[model samples]
Target: MEELTLTTPALLFSAISLIMLAYTNRFLAYAAIIRNLSDKYLKHQDASVLRQIKNLRLRIQLTRYMQIAGISSLLFCVLTMFLIYIHYPIVAVWAFGLGLVLLILSLLFLIWEIQISAKSLQHHLGDIENHFKK
Candidate 1:
């Protein structure tokens, strides 16, 4: 393997930071949606509202997992850099590989969450369509 430099792991720092920021934004948006939906359901008790609540719950869970994975990747990247600093190239490579895998997993979960979010939006649009048909 090519020599592992501190710069190698450092490269992921900015990317991971950006990803974590995106994840946080998604999480905040979900939280706002859930709270608003909850208040609406309390007042109206609509079935469609219940369905939306369920869907948001699942999306929230997926977002949590994605955030967890991203955090793990960041932690591992830092560990890899520390290992490299200490002159442990072999273990550092392994840590770096694990970090990459975690990053990929986070991205996959993010994609899944986005798909669910789109479907939820479509459900809302279906309601609008039904209302217009009346």
Candidate 2:
């Protein structure tokens, strides 16, 4: 097998790190938005707000899971990159592939969570509309 270069692993690690950071930031922003909405509109003891809060809580939990996965993947990528540089090309390749899989899984979970949140919001809006009709 040809000797592995550090550049390939280094670039992969950098990309994974950036992706993880972006995912973490997205989770934080989502949590902030939910909190702000609850504080502003749910103060009147509205049931819909309560439902929304519950949905947000679930979404946050999923986001947390994804964030954890993303971070772990990034860490593995870095470690593998170092191994590759040290002449363990086969091991490094396996590690890099595993890291990539983890990152992809995290992204899939994030997408699912967002879809759930959107569905919950749509349901809440529908309920509000029905309230107005009566």
Candidate 3:
């Protein structure tokens, strides 16, 4: 295999930083939505709103997992760079590989969350349709 230099891990820095930024933004959006939902639930306690809250709760948890995996990926990449700096090329390669795996896991979580989000939207749409039908 080719040499695992510091530059190899350094290359991931920009990509990981952007991903972390996106994940943070997602978390912030969820927080805002949760707060809004909480207020609505407090005021009315409607079954529909409660269902939405439950959906949001699951989405928020998945978002947290995504953030954790993404952060761990960044941490591993940093570790890889450190290992390279200390002249452990083999170990650096392994660390970098682990980082990649974590990143992939994060993306998988994101996909799952998105699927759930779409389903939730569809449920809302179904409610609207039922109201119109009535």
Q: Which prediction has the highest lDDT against the true structure?
A: 1
Worst 10 residues of 3 by lDDT: 1-10
User: Tell me, what's the RMSD of every candidate?
Assistant: 0.8, 2.7, 1.0
- CA lDDT, candidate 2, residue 127: 82
- lDDT by residue for model 1 over 3-113, one digit each (tens)? 989898899999999999999998999899889999999999999889888888899899899999999999999999999989898999999999999999999999999
In Å, residue 59's CA in model 2 sits off its true spot by 1.0
Candidate 1 lDDT for residue 105 = 99
Query: What does candidate 2's lDDT look like per residue over 32-83, in tens digits?
Result: 9787877867568777667777877888888888888788788778878788
Model 2 ranges off by over 4 Å = 1-4, 37-42, 127-134
Compared with the true structure, what per-residue lDDT tens digits does model 3 show for residues 1-134? Answer: 57888887788889889988988898899899889989988999899888888898999899899989989999999999899889888888999999999999999999999999999999989999999999
What stretches of model 3 exceed 4 Å from their correct place?
none
Note the clash tally of each candidate: 0, 0, 0
Q: Give lDDT for model 3.
A: 0.90
State the local distance difference test value for candidate 1: 0.92
Best by TM-score: 1
Give TM-scores for every candidate, taking all chains together and pairing residue i with residue i.
0.96, 0.78, 0.95
